[model samples]
Target: MQAFLQQLPALIGVVIGALASFAATSAAERSRWRRTQSVRWDERRLTAYAEYASAVKKVISLSVRIAAHRGIHPDIDALPPEEGLPALAAAEEERTVKWETVLLLGTGSTVVAARAWHESAFRLQRIASGREVELSWSEAIDAVSKARRRFYEAAKADIGIALGDVPESYDWQISRLIAADSTPPERNT
Candidate 1:
C-alpha cells in the first residue's frame, strides 16, 4: 500500500504530460489543415474573379463591336449579343464551380454587381433576339454599352484586389503594382 501511494504522483504527472502533448499535436494539425483550406479558397476566389472578369470583358468587347456597327464604338462591328450570352453564362458557371470559395475569399460586392450587370446584359440580348423586343435596337445597344463599361471598370478594380492583379482597363492599378525594378505582384505571388 505504501509503495502504490508513493508512485501515484509520478503516474499522474506522466498522464498529464501525455495529455498535453496530444492536445498540442491536435492543435497544430488542425491549424495546418485550416491554412491549407484557406490557401485553396484563396486560389479559387482569384480564379473566379479573373474568369468572371474575362467573361464580362468579352461581353464588353462585343458591345464595342456592336456600337461600332451603330457608329458608337470605334471601328467595331463584331457583336452578336444573342449568341454571346449563352457562352458567357457557361463561362460564369465554370468559373464559379466552387461557391464557398467566392463567398469566403472574394468580395461579395463584386459578385453582386457582376450578377446585376449580367442580368441587364441578358435583358438587352433578349431585346436583340427574343419573343418580342421590349426595347428598341438602339436602346438595347446603348444599355449593353453602359453595362459593359461598368462591368469592365468594376471587374478591373475587384480582380486587382482578388488576385493581387490589375484589371486590363485600370491603368492605375497596373502601375501601382508594377515594381520599378521588380516584377508585378501577381507574377511574384
Candidate 2:
C-alpha cells in the first residue's frame, strides 16, 4: 500500500504530460487543415480570375478586328469584314461561360470588377457590331482600357500580389493596347 501511494504522483505526472502532448498535436492538426483550405481556395480564385480576364480579352480583340474590318475603324482593319462576324459571336459565347465561372468563384470585390470589365467590353462590342449606339474607335478603346486597368488593380488587391510583381507579359499587353489607341493606325502600303 505504501509503495502504491508513493508512486501515485509519478503516474499523475505521466498522465498529465500525455494529455498535454495530445492537445498540442490536435491543435497543430487543426491549424494545418485551415492553412490547406486557405491555399486551395486561393488557387481556385486565381484560376477564376485568369479565366475570366482571358476570355474577356479575347472578346475585346475580336471586337476590335470586327470594327476595323467593317470600316468603323478603317485604318486598323486586320481581317476581312465578312470574316469577323462569326468570330466575334464565338468569342462572345466563350466570354459568357467564363463570366459565369467568375460569378461563382470570385470574391465580392473581384466580382464587381469583373462585371465592370465585362460591361465595358460589351459596350464596345455592341458599337463595333452595330447592335447599338455608335462610338469612335478611340472612344471605345479608351473606355475598355480604363475598365481593364480597374479589373487588374482589383485582382491584384484580392490576390495579395503586389502590382510590381505582376507578370511583365500582362503589363506589356495592356500597355500595347493603350498605346495602339494613342495614335491612328498607319495605312498599309
Global Cα RMSD, each model: 11.5, 3.6
lDDT top scorer: 2
Off by over 4 Å in 2: 1-5, 74-77, 134-136, 165-189
Q: Compared with the true structure, what per-residue lDDT tens digits does model 1 show for residues 117-177?
A: 6666555444433326566444554454555455555544654443344334444322332
Name the 10 consecutive residues with the lowest summed lDDT in model 1: 180-189
Top candidate when judged by TM-score against the true structure: 2
Give per-model TM-scores. 0.53, 0.79
Where is model 2 poorest over a 10-residue stretch in terms of lDDT? 180-189
Provide the overall lDDT of each model, using Cα atoms, as 2-decimal numbers. Answer: 0.52, 0.76
Candidate 1 ranges beyond 4 A from true positions: 76-110, 120-189
Compose the digit string of candidate 2's lDDT tens values, residues 1-189: 999999999999999999999999999999999999878987888888888889999888888776666555543446654676788788889889988887887778888888888888888788777676565666667777777877887887777777675555345655565566566444432
